[model samples]
Target: MMVQCVICDILEELDNTAPEAKRLRNRPIHTYMCAACHERVTARTNERIATGKFRFYRSSRRIEGDFYS
Candidate 1:
């Protein structure tokens, strides 16, 4: 049996102006199913999450003083 892998994107909203839109615009959120396909969508989603590519950050703190001080 031959198995084929599919790629997809999961987003909250579909906005062309959105920053995420650019990256996932051309990608498919769902994968195609065919004979002998054992790949799970959940697995793929987990991989993406672990990569930090979909992380949300508000702000970062900085050290104003000198390191030696």
Candidate 2:
């Protein structure tokens, strides 16, 4: 399967049988990130974490539950 990196927009070919390729085929909202960009971002994020200033925000499942209740 042919996929493009969401960060760098580089075209890459993936094995059609690979799980990632299947995921992209099945989900339109899921994006593909090339290995290079993935590594770069990981390194940068690690650096920020080491500096003690990185913040990771996650959606609150508790808030959603409360809203439905």
Candidate 3:
């Protein structure tokens, strides 16, 4: 199956029987990211987290309650 990376727009080929291919075929909302783009994003996110000022604005309500407790 042919899939395009949502981040880099690069085209990649996956085996027809691959689980990822099946997932993309069955679920339209899921997105694909190339390995390089994924790694880059991961590294940048870690950097931000290490800066001690990163905030997760979308944190769960349960976590917010726990924080105030």
Against the reference, the lDDT scores of all candidates come to 0.43, 0.86, 0.86
Q: Identify the runs in model 3 with alpha carbons over 4 angstroms from their true place.
A: 61-69
lDDT of 1 by residue, 1-69 (tens): 121234332222345665445544455574334323335655665687678675435533333123112
CA shift of 25, model 1, Å: 31
Task: Report the number of clashing residue pairs per model.
Answer: 2, 0, 0
Off by over 4 Å in 2: 59-69
Error of 1 at 39 (Å): 6.7
Question: lDDT of candidate 3?
Answer: 0.86
RMSD of 1: 14.0
Query: Evaluated with lDDT, which candidate comes out highest?
Result: 3
Worst 10 residues of 2 by lDDT: 59-68
| lDDT value, residue 55 of candidate 1 | 42
Best model per TM-score: 2
How many Å off is the CA of 32 in candidate 1? Answer: 13
TM-score of 3: 0.75
